[model samples]
Target: MRRSAEPDPSGEQAPHWWQRAVFYQVYVRSFADSDGDGVGDLEGIRSRLGYLELLGVDALWLTPFFRSPMADHGYDVADPRAVDPLFGDLAAFDRLVTDAHAHGIKVTIDVVPNHTSDQHAWFQEALAAAPGSRERARYLFRDGDQPPNNWVSVFGGPAWTRVPDGQWYLHLFTPQQPDLNWDNSEVRADLVETLRFWLDRGVDGFRIDVAHGMAKPAGLPDMPEYLRSVTGAQAHGVDDPRFDNDEVHEVHRLIRKVADEYPDTMAVGEIWVQTDTQFAKYVRQDELHLGFNFALVDADFDADAVRRAIDLSLEAVSRSAAPPTWTLSNHDVVRHVTRYGGSELGARRARAMALVQLALPGVVYLYNGEELGLPNVELPDWALQDPLWERSGHTDRGRDGARVPLPWEGTEPPFAFSEGTNTWLPIPPEWAGLTVERQLEDPDSMLSLYRQALELRKTHAGFSGTDIEWYGAPPGCFAYRRKGGGLICALNTSGAPVPLPPGEILLSSGPIPTTDLPPETAVWLI
Candidate 1:
């Protein structure tokens, strides 16, 4: 296959580098450990830049490293300008950015604009006695005995929690992560200031958390009771007034304004909506540069589901004239390998999924350790740290199973994280054999396949472009073709033998055994 034309990067005609780039998502608490502490820090990430570069990622997305109480694993921000001491200070973060850029890798940090820690000074002052105080207006407060309305929290409980002195405040996650009042102009301006602070510091961009939830319905109405179940619950509902509130556009516009001030700076949003149309709205030219498509994350591994999702996503992006972005897994969800394919066939399926995602037209996001084909580790109730585990009564293990620290060294003593006295989450027993060191030396390992796949993507013309055609196929068989740049790419997502029309094979999950697959086999043909 011919190589794709080099990306245009000359003058005003240059395309954004992120448009054709691959991004690596780093969950800080689980990525690497620098100090003897059990937690992964900026220095730990700094030490792994070369490993990422070797694995073929263009940039890195670090989940929030800001000063927080760790209520939601750093999503509850207390200070946006400073880094949390547990993850190292501002100086350490600056060093990470500097070293990352030196290694040709751009860095984007998670920015939680929708809320702040209850311990934040702004929230503290809001709770204090004051009439029409600026700090009080920073967050929503209800005067009556009841809440401002009856909206439920996304984390399975009442959205409103009462503060001391008898006033109700909104909290979308835990009471610790108090929702900020976007209705307040002061709050919006403050958020813009926070964006500017990070941008001016040499940070590349941001991954806007809960970008859609930043704005709430004016009169928070009662969400349906059926949506409140702890397990098997539809965390988000169409009937819920919180669905794509119009006020959210204003927040995006403000964020866009901030991005415009910096050259080549990008902002990607975590908009967890049902439809592709709703997701597209967040990526308008004047809004966020990219918004994650959650359809793939929630989709079953069947062919029809994957085809429909790709079709809908393509249509949405084409309609909005915006670039698309795909995320298979993140800190909030089950690991892709475990969720899509069972433990027995998980690794094989994961490789095929990577080719599919990488071949799609847009920015590709890779979660840490995904290249190693890491499976979910079962943690006992006593060792789990996610609040969701406790909140949901252990019905769901929350995300701890997937958020364990990355195994860089052999799974022994510090598990390659830190030589510290205690690790935050216990390293799983199997991690010893799946360490990065072991994978690097093995020729047929998932890590090696990932490197080759990314190199192929960077050099293949068939992998680039926005035009795509979803081909009809059998059950459990997903196929798609991208036609442009003088190349045609097709993929099969089934365990059965798929007859390839007259094209050469570009990539396949594993050796073809008897022209039949066990399960979760993927093939790419040109």
Candidate 2:
């Protein structure tokens, strides 16, 4: 693919690197551990820059490592500017950025603007102050007898938590993550300063957490009955007071203003709005540069479902002329390998889907450990750490399974992730054949396929386009050709093999000894 360039400050064309860049999401605590404390840290990530550069990703998004109480891992941040001692100090973060940039890689960190750790000074002060005091005004605190309106937490239970003073505060996720009042000028200004602090320190950009949140509707009305359940709310849309509020756009516009000051820096939102029009609002010209359209992530492995997701995502981003982004897995969801089918069959589908995702235009985000074909590990009840486990009374199991530490090397439990024979979450003994050391020696390995696909996506003229043209295919299969670049990507999700398109095969998820695309296989052709 040709490099994407945009106009710079002096009217000179410069590489708008992020437009077609591949971003790898690094869940910090599970990536690597240099201190052998059973937790991954900055120095460990800095030590792995060569691996990332060789893997061929243009940038990496690190999950929150800011100072926190670890209530929701690092999401419950106590200090937005300070790095937690658990992940190393701010100086360690600087070293990681410097070394990463030296290796020609960009660094983007997570910004949790919708809420702050309950232990954060602001939240703590809000707790200490009177009901309507200035300190309490920065957060949503309601003094009522019936606990405001009925709204449930995304995790579980009521969204409002009562203070000892008989007033209630809003917490969309956990009580530990208090929702911030964006209506307060102080809250907006503080977020701006946080953005500048990291940009000045040489970071590339940010992944805004809960980008559709931070604003609440007037009256805090009760959510409609049909959207009361967690699954129902996610399926229907974000029409509740808890999320996707109209005022959220103003917050994103504020963020875009700060990002514009730094050239080539972009802000991608984790928007969960349902409709194409609603999702487009977050990426408007004056808002975020990109929004994470999770259609592909949420879609089933069926060919028709996959095609629909791609089509909807393209249409949504086209409204604002914003670049579209795609992903198969992230820290918060089940790994795609397991989500597909959870065994050898799942691995095959995942490999095929990787080509499908990388073949599309625009930016792509690859989750850490995804290249190794990592599947979600079924952990014992005693080993689960996600707050949802406790918050849901152990019924939901939470996301801890997907967040297991990466298996870098070795044959046993820790898999060389930590010098100690332990990890924050156990690495199953079955991953012996999937370690990076083992896979690097095998050309047919998942890691090798990813490395090759990413390199091809970067240099192949066949991948240079912003739009795709649909090609008719057999039932249970789909094909699309890149406009302006005659690259063809085809996939077979049917029960049997299908005829291959007439073209020079560039790459395939599985070997094609015959002139046919086998079930659960995808190929890139030119």
Candidate 3:
């Protein structure tokens, strides 16, 4: 069982640290570089610990850095227990965790339990073993030349690949990654051991990749309808059949049991189910500590869309002990700046949405470069490396645009991302004006807005409650007050100004008009 670090000193009940903590997702390759090796490494993360601390985030969710063939950029784990050499060895990871904790930032590493790299020892052994061997049973191996079912890979193409021995293996993602057979006891025990390996290393938690995908549906039936193998695939809901299988909950239950052994450790799942009830199931008392609902992330910048997204998000977790995790952007999707439509209007809406996200009742996840108001770049076809690029037959540009390395300073390519123009993904030269260095010098920049909001959200008495009450507002606008708390947040989605309600202005995403809230802006009040 988990041990409580802090006893209830005042006898007044409150939530866990993660319930109110602001988490910053650091896509390792794009974040920073200390080794001048073009790719960001664990050493790079340690060097930037102070920056994350000053940014006021309580936790840093580092994307996968495990040993891999880079087929999926660390998500295809060749060695789950070892750190990839590109990101340094286990020692470097340990130093990063220690330095981050010293700076009061918790570290949550990405854990991909759903599949293993085709090159993983287990998979390789399975490939060499006979069809009926125990090694073959550890993964989804089928005897026929045809795939077990018609399920397609998330990246694109057929989901199964035939081995030289004429057997098939399932991979919901790329062919480089083969799905593990969770019904196989060896696979289940291996995952538990992998969890223990990291927990014993002192990492605080895990951001489970494809957490809802660990279990394949019984009998492996083909989907009635085709769905894209991406974030939007979950829109098919309960009967989607490809993911969110009912048995996935048992996987989480086992994981939660393992997590409980380490006090204060958390497991946040990427549960992409559609309905509010479906979304809530992953975070029930015996499952995940938090389930990411992409309702707000996929919503448009319109008033009604934003309102409905929030309603569904809240309703999704209203019945669970776990809080909803909110994020406007992540590594997989297009950055919100470009998604909202680029330039001025896009920037305004992005900032406004940030205010809404930060003022919400639960956990908030900020993707790197978002505070810099970075727009997605239009990369050349040759520059695209997402597996989706190849799998989609070059029809899709893939996620290289949002995965560009962040610019810390300077005015050119690499932008201090590394010593030369050899960054893993090119950093846009135009980002010169949006570097963290430039933004810090300009107090009114997006970086300042986020910094101030995060600090206030952490320190102020106004942001004390979890409940929200809707306030009457004009069309194309929203106003909500925190129940039992002094804070109120209002956003004007209209093109024209809207009247402000009674309260002292605590913070605004942008400058406010003399007597009303300006268009495409959000304000916090008390």
Candidate 4:
């Protein structure tokens, strides 16, 4: 391994830092709790910047912490400019931003663009104004309350909610997150202003939420019934006229214009478009800098599936000459550990996949607690908080299972996540052995493996290129060499073991119990 090819994080010369950065996603309420308020806050994140610095991430993305009613847990922003009291006030956020920069970590916060909190001032005013008034025009308020068209909420209900005035407003998500009418110039202007507000406050960039659905088709129309059950802000969000329309490109272009005002600042979209071509549109030359391709996150832990994920992900980004972004899990989906199989085998695969992701030549995103190899917690019904839990009549388990608080240092429940027992979501009792403190002492632990891989990814010459050349391999196994960089990444997704390619080993997720790589294991070589 060599020293980083890039300049120091504090250096101002690396104008294209985003092209080579590795981002860690910080799920605010679950990352850490400095206030003992049973929730993770910006101050807690500031306190843990050293841990992240040592763990080797270039930057971090904090899920929304702005002023909000917490309807969608901060995604429903009441005021994008103000820090929410729940995550500490503006002063605390400022301190976190200052500290993070000092630690050489860039701060990218979530910006929800497609909708506004129903409790937002604009929405409140819209509710009181006459049907055709400017206030109402800020939103998609329609006449004839028979539930405007047949659109369904992504959270599983009617997208239209009638107000006292007898007109219905559209909300692609839960009614609490009312969809804004982007057709209105005021709506577009406010969003650009919002971007500048945070940029001027010294933040690095933004992770645009629902980045693909901001523009709806003109003349609201009916959608297929099947879309209702799958409609969401997650991976399945791209069907129908309500999402990924060509007009959305204009919205992104305007956003990119605002972001370009801040040097080195970039935007990554939560684009859920179904095809590589459609996904590429969001990352065109004048739009978002990156778009999350969830192929890796949605794939099963098998050789063919994993290969396809990598290929498709890269193809999509290549369409716009944009760099690929990789991740196996995030806030909206089941953790890969649990999704892989929920046992020792599952944990093994998760660790292996982490290397597969880091070995790629693009931005890599690790969700909070992912470094600790945390699995999803199956919460009791009474403890669930995701709106989808109730919105689907309790038939859908929702995302609470994956949002459990991170277990940091302790051996018990709050596990150093908080001083109190009221964490937003309960940590499983069995996670005692997987705490960061414990993993720090075990070289074979998942945490250590991640640190080593990241450290190598940052300094090794083998990780510099974006192109990959595949090598013929046994069934249930895959091997690929990085172009222009003499590095190889191999995986054993089968029940049996496979021999590693001939090269000096750079890293492996765990011990190679034999001459062959174990099942669910991945290795890096040069």
Per-residue C-alpha lDDT of model 1 across residues 1-526, encoded as one tens digit per residue = 1113344555456667888789999999889988888999999999989999899899999999889998888989999888999999888988999999999999998989889998898988888856467778888777777777767666656778886677788887888988888888888888888988888778778998887787888677777777666332236766667557978988999998888878788898888777766777888878988887777777777666776777777776776756778778888888988986656577777777777777788788889988888888788789988877766666667788888888887648456788785788887767777788989998788898888888888887767566766666566675667666433334455655765534567776676555443356666667
Could you give candidate 2's per-residue lDDT for residues 1-526 as a string of tens digits? 1123355688876447888899999999999999999999999898888899989999999999999999999999999999999999988999999999999999999999999999999998988899899899999999888779888788877889999999999988899999899999999999999999999898899999988888899888888876656532134355666788889999999999988888778899988887898998898899998899999999999999999999999999887858889999999899999999989999999999999999999999999999999999999999999988888877889899999999988788688788887889998999999999999999999999999999999999999989999999999999999996899999999999999998999999999989999999999999
Q: List the residue pairs that clash in candidate 4.
A: none
For model 2, give the RMSD to the true fold. 2.8
> Model 3 segments beyond 4 Å from truth?
1-4, 12-14, 228-237
Instruction: Report the backbone clash tally of model 4.
Output: 0
RMSD for each of the candidates:
3.9, 2.8, 1.6, 3.5
Q: Tell me the lDDT of model 4 at 526.
A: 96
TM-score of each candidate?
Answer: 0.94, 0.97, 0.97, 0.96
TM-score of 1: 0.94
Better of 1 and 4 by TM-score: 4
Report the CA-based lDDT of candidate 2 relative to the real structure: 0.91
User: Residue 29's C-alpha lDDT in candidate 2?
Assistant: 98
Per-residue lDDT value at 271 in model 1 = 81
Off by over 4 Å in 4: 1-15, 235-239
Residue range 324-386, candidate 4, lDDT tens digits = 998888999999999999888789889889989999888988998889888888899999999
Minimal lDDT window, size 10, model 4 = 1-10
Comparison by TM-score, 2 against 4, better one = 2
In angstroms, what RMSD does candidate 1 have relative to the true structure? 3.9
